[model samples]
Target: MTTISKTRIDGMPIGLTLALLLACAVNLAVLARWL
Candidate 1:
């Protein structure tokens, strides 16, 4: 149980980073289309 929780904690930052990057890419695409 501890190991599983540790792995999940480790994965969270990577997931968050990916989500932020994806959001940034989507925002940039929208801005480009509007401009």
Candidate 2:
């Protein structure tokens, strides 16, 4: 996980990127339940 994250653009804040990833996971979970 650490290695993959290291390759991201340095212009973006890590915290914001992590939040987006978390939000995506939450959305996927919600959709999975409905399906």
On TM-score, the candidate that comes out on top is 2
Which residue segments of model 2 deviate by more than 4 Å?
A: 1-9
Each model's TM-score? 0.64, 0.69
Q: Residues 1-35, candidate 1, lDDT per residue (tens digit)?
A: 99996787577888786787799999999999999
List the global CA lDDT of all models: 0.85, 0.82
Which sections of candidate 1 miss by over 4 Å? 1-12
Enumerate residue pairs that collide in model 1: none
RMSD of candidate 2 to the truth, in angstroms, is 3.6
Query: TM-score of the candidate numbered 2?
Result: 0.69
Best by lDDT: 1
